[model samples]
Target chain A: MSCVTPSWSVAMKKNQLRVNEFGLIERFFRPLAVNNPGSASLQDDCATLSVKKGYQAIYSMDTMVEGIHFFKDDPADLIAKKLLRVNLSDLAASGGHPRGYLLALCLPHGFPLKWLENFSAGLQDDQTKFNVSLVGGDTTSSNGPITLSITAIGEIPKGRVIRRAGAMVGDDIFVSGCIGDAAIALKLFEEIGRAKTLKHYPSLYNRYILPEPRIGLGKLLAGTATACIDISDGLYADLNHICLASKVGAKIEMGAIPLSICATNIIEKNKDYWESVYGGGDDYELLFTANKDQRNVIENFASILNISISKVGCIQSGKGISILDQFGHVVPVRSFGWQHF
Target chain B: MSCVTPSWSVAMKKNQLRVNEFGLIERFFRPLAVNNPGSASLQDDCATLSVKKGYQAIYSMDTMVEGIHFFKDDPADLIAKKLLRVNLSDLAASGGHPRGYLLALCLPHGFPLKWLENFSAGLQDDQTKFNVSLVGGDTTSSNGPITLSITAIGEIPKGRVIRRAGAMVGDDIFVSGCIGDAAIALKLFEEIGRAKTLKHYPSLYNRYILPEPRIGLGKLLAGTATACIDISDGLYADLNHICLASKVGAKIEMGAIPLSICATNIIEKNKDYWESVYGGGDDYELLFTANKDQRNVIENFASILNISISKVGCIQSGKGISILDQFGHVVPVRSFGWQHF
Candidate 1:
């Protein structure tokens, strides 16, 4: 009889150090879900989700692929955190509080057990930090580099969810935290030979790798901000989204835009580099528009949250986005932000 | 001056026919989501989900990879339906009715636009058929084969969800519809040289590609069936899941195991083929256990749903499963369905 090796046997041969999918899940994923009664210890095919009374759930999913999203040699722990944080950022923009998330991992053959262990460790850390739990997910082998998808569920009080289309003319456009650190850091990483220069901006590099989702600020802005969005596809592109959705326009003042010390230092040396600082993506900062009358209230709220807020622009009656210098002349931008096709 | 190509330009170069991801979403995905108010016309990053009063949401996620799960040439429509159906099946097994789902697609570079169109059409068909809608999802490019992950949401009355561990000793083990068709069809396809034999089992082949989730039957069985699971990993393996979860054992009679005429003919040719029929995977039928006293009630419910219900065994107070032939002799099965490594 000709022996025919099963597909799974072939998989085992390639990764002798790898635990089977089920065992891996049982050891690493099940523990993260213990607090979630609906997860059923990851034993059942689906999990049950409970929503708080007078609350609606917010849902969002994002995918990260190796090489395209991050470097192959990046630490698994950071990857896990970045994946969850990005989705959490969505909730932040919508004024939702993190509740739980589902994860789907597609790993190439010979994927390491240690990688999964570290990834789960990262998730455990964030689950505690964000006060959310793992709901349910699936792990499978793929023929390509590692790809991950996270579906995050957050809760908002009934009819209280913030949206991107509520900005009105004359609304004050504000941004939380410093913008462009992630974009600059990403640029430094892409120019692999610029390792020497990257050492000068450690903070920017850290910001790119691990973004802090402004959940606190977002919750505070729910009833106050007229419109809101998290900065992922750069400030300009994302601002354009609010404009498109609200059928309005915006003019950002370059001088008033918040920048970290490191970003200021880089821009001072090469003023032309401002495009990358402003239009490069992955900031994860909250960009929102609020009634000008609420300026003082918003400022106090930002202080309470201990996050920097900048009134960089105003919503106008027209469409599209424009950037202005301190003298109020429109400055043409090279590109809007990172575009994934 | 050396002209440096922007990252987005590089992506555009690789997929000349592809539009930017945002525009692609607007054209293809947004239409399907328009009906769901919470989807926000796919404008905002996250979608809002409003659960009915006195109901808890059920969530499940599953991933399918090209080549690993389906052939490269598999019709996009079938692939899309399969992706949704598998997750829907999970909800059905959990006694939840489909409400909505979030999909994440990681398509290979140069993936066809027509394929995506067909895939969306399939989703539209199933959404109408099953009364579910697309709430939200993310789409991105991958360097490898296509990979898709779906997170399906369903709802059931608060505290009324079915589970796998509720079976009691002496409970009647039941399954919906005929078994082994998908597995047999998969085998026939794998041995491509025997394409002539596959023509004889058109029904089996169809079952393999498109599984009709017994949603109506599952809903009817919700509070009545003591324990339940969907039979994706063959009858024996899934039965073992219910057995393991309920801490019970079972004995299934080979003669009583329901099979279509095509499966019967194949098994008759080789009595050993019974292992494949009973131990093969991807059946997508519901394997449930109910109290023996509720047999008439379950039969009546099955009749109302117009689906076949077979009682193949009884739960015993033990720790494993056994297969017995018509003459009461234990049958030696080789394996327990498909085990993904």
Candidate 2:
């Protein structure tokens, strides 16, 4: 009864205007419209969205340029999934449920249509896994890198959503999933120059290529966590956002930080890579704060989500993040977050 | 008191992560969030949206690339407005009222910050004119041409939304405002190559730079018109979209198609430019259909809106379009829509 996004079936039928684009949508994206009724098979220029009675719509947009966000030689499917996941991570941090998204891609002139097949397939996989749908989007050609922008829309109960501005002093800080694996993958990628196989630690390569969004964990943290953010800009940098917003300080211990076996092994051999743990980003994990009373609930959340949830630090009375070592001595922070490509 | 976007004042205080980007938002974009409660001043990664009863949220996205959608040297402010207006035009076609929007900018590396001030000023002006607010978005640097993507959101009464599939045979095809001016400007741009002032017909140049979205007219037509669309691709191509969606044919006399004084003068000097009038795009006007009995009402809509509404053709029970010359012979079509960069 309500109109949302009419799918591409309307425009693609003509195939006389922007023939390649219509064809691309028809063959690749039209199938991804299964989640919502307003998709009308991508026939209309605009799609309609509606919110439920107790919920409000949540949105975030992230742009990823080839070579800046991912290597050009990466699998098209992984590239598409990573782009979607990063935006989803933001919504998760807000404790919203996955819903639908809009994607805009600017490709180099004469972009191969085959790449879209792989790209949309990646979207197909994630849309199924996350139980979301492709509501609307468009694509165009340029001389620039393959540029991707996705506006992710979700929903959260009006009363349950968390924010970055609610942390209180003495609140325990928790991070979901492992931290430095993706950052290490970036380093490995630069060293190997897009080798089809990473000569070692394929899990590190996998984590880099595909990130698992902490959507379930994030939703569980809602109402319980006082403040929350996603770890896209490295742990310290993203946590600093919490401190600045909540007008508090934080003390996170390096020993309490969760790490994958591969990451730990690499760090044991070379201390220089510690900077990656502290400053390198692309984690796509949830970072949040809750009072000491919520510690047991958070531990239960970790078990329920089947992902590691570490007590990295606690909110302090002052300002900024203090990165303490195993000996409780402050470790000099090397870097913060994304430096432009 | 419902938490929406917790503006950038929170994360921007640190100024250590993505410093250039945070500074850009603080200087230019933070000023444009005047229209919505959810726009927490561009600080948070995501914003929340709520829809009112009896309405459904309408959404559409448009992406523009330098050298593809517009010239690289075009004024940054005009470029920004056009990008926003184009997406707004899509929403207007669906009979949606202006609401809030998200923007994603992929700028060339070392993009001058001053250009952003001009660009944001353009958005500020239009956001005020349209009474919409900036909700959320992100920007990243790339080596590619300037790429801007906008997702415009609006609201339309559930029962009154117009769709392209609803037009029936015998419906009178109508277009709002003059059609050929922007197309003429495109051709003139090719001939002049970035001249500051047009030696002739500055109106055409102006139309190409900034398009007026018929948002108000679209809302008025929602319940009265059978179907509607905005002309972004030339009128012929866009009309063909309606025909394809509605499963109908169209017959329009070239002489009946409205043209601006400047466009008429150009066509008089050289008939070769007729193709530009017929197939050239970038005109953000509404084209719709109504049954014969509604002619008087359509005329009233025109007068009420203070814009000319011309009946160019009638929908027939078939497919495709027939463009008739002054002598009633069918004019052969050259192109229908956008080609790549």
Candidate 3:
């Protein structure tokens, strides 16, 4: 993967007021807790949460390090939104409803307080958008680049939450939104103004920065989908999780996999880009499987949610993922998906 | 705040085997979930947690960074134990019982898989000791030093949780266990061989590395203590939090503050070290406030728990923490506590 450092010029500000940790929290993060009674206004050592009767809680945590998961120059709000949304995406894959989240921010000493303010504002925006609130967190100084970690909490009915091991043979493989836009957008980041297709479809740039999690679709698929996962490490990599966990195989038709128009144009321009389009990650879309009989109900759900739902493959009584070409033959790929290592 | 980089000579090993991300997780982390049904053997994107009926869940997060939180050459196992125990300490402050936790680990590329093995072993040890399990987390490559973040979840009876804002004016400030051992030990790090006192009190050095969270005492204080907090950011700084939150002040007698024989010996050598002894952090002891009448009950609780309980101060109807000398005059200090900034 190409590593391009974004312009940090805008983030370099002057005359910023120096603030201590407590002051930073009070001025910035406290407002995000306006609606969460359990947060206790960030006063107590721990936040309080009450699970409703007959429901189980879903917990997940992810960390994003500067220059690795995101560029240092990325907008604070977009970064915040991406952090929260990615965790929510995990909850979505689990067929759970978002409730609240905890954040741990490790910043370099002398970090700009304005950046903290913008980051908090970003969280505030998403706290309202996703109906989740900030509950508790720790703020500490790091000797390295900025790192943010979040643990998102959600709720699901007991015995109803979907797992990767639940996929069965003959289940229809489905995806909630277009795949690979984030990866393609990241590729075009190097080409930017020189790419003709990007001139017409500039939204792909924002797609790489901020992913739209399929929360409503996931909730809708709670009863319909047999197995589910979020596409963060590319379709093949994530699908392999379900395959390995369920002890099943899958055959995804390369031509049937949904793609954004911009991704299609880029892939058509160069066959080499197909690898990234198929294997690159960070799509944050739901990849799931359901019984063939539930196709009509899923279609109705997609229609009601006004989102695209594609049937791309089927679960087979085997192991590993196969990409079936347009000629109905399996085509081997160089890599499955993004590997952090 | 002396920044001493410890020797990394022991951490470096030859011909260390390389492992992919998934392989590392499978070999190192999966076993930590041996008894946690909700962990699903670390396969699912989210972990399942069911809160018992009539109970409220408590959530908290804390981060530890190499060089800042711990020396870069520190044993991976000790680092892991400290990370989990710190979060558990917070749960203890809230009068919550340990349940489970999620961890996010960011390590530099080419990090030794052996280090991961030792780190997982450390977590396994604490999971057994604390009865908490690892549910879910994200492991990603970092460009800088190792960073670890954990979000611990705990359970408490409904409406029986403790907070830092419930202390009354006449409440007595009580602290569990000895304090300043960690800070004093940290101060002695540079004088290891030169200081004869450290040779006599080697346990203080171990106390600095490993903190024993007062889980039983905290549970006992749930209904009796008015307000409670864990002493991670020094006693004066944390007590000031309760003062600010509960709109109260405190007058602590310097002579009455609990201290181990080792800490007492170190402080007796130099009166100027009293600031760190009093306001230095990382003790992880429980500093709480309770009605004067509940003193005997607290002593009984401490007796049963086999821990020391000391009443060092009384909450006043004012604003800041006042440290009284042996002669009843206020002693001005250089710093309040450990400040992240």
Which candidate has the top score in lDDT?
1
lDDT of each residue in B1-341, candidate 1, tens digit only: 00022334654443343677788788878888889998888889789877789989999899998877777777899999999999999999988889999989887665667888899999989999998888889887777788899999998888878898899999999988998888877766656533554477778867877999878887888889999999887899888888887889998988888999988898887665677678887789999999989999989988898888999998998788889988999988787677555
Ranking by lDDT: 1, 3, 2
| Candidate 2 DockQ, CA atoms | 0.36
Candidate 2 chain B, poorest ten consecutive residues by summed lDDT: B1-10
Candidate that beats the other on DockQ, 2 or 3, i.e. the better one: 3
Taking the tens digit of each residue's C-alpha lDDT, what string does model 1 give over A228-265? 99998889989998999999998899999899998898
Residues B1-341 of candidate 2 have per-residue lDDT tens digits of 00111122224322222245666677777788745768656666688767677888888989987777777677889988998899989889989997889998887654666678789989988888888888988877766788889998888888677888888999999999998788777776665544733656678878887999999899888889999999887788888888988888999988889999888888898887788777877888898999899999989988998999999999998778999988999999976655442
Q: By the TM-score metric, which is better: model 1 or model 3?
A: 1
TM-score of chain B of each: 0.94, 0.92, 0.93
lDDT of 3 by residue, B163-246 (tens): 999999999999998888887776666555314534766787567668888888888889999999999878899998888889
Error of 2 at A258 (Å): 0.6
CA lDDT, every model vs. true structure: 0.84, 0.80, 0.83
Q: Model 1, DockQ value?
A: 0.49
How well does candidate 1 match the true structure, expressed as C-alpha RMSD? 3.0
Best by TM-score: 1
What global local distance difference test value does model 3 have? 0.83
- Residues A138-223, model 2: lDDT tens digits: 86766678889999988889867788889998899998888988887776666554463366768887877787888998788888
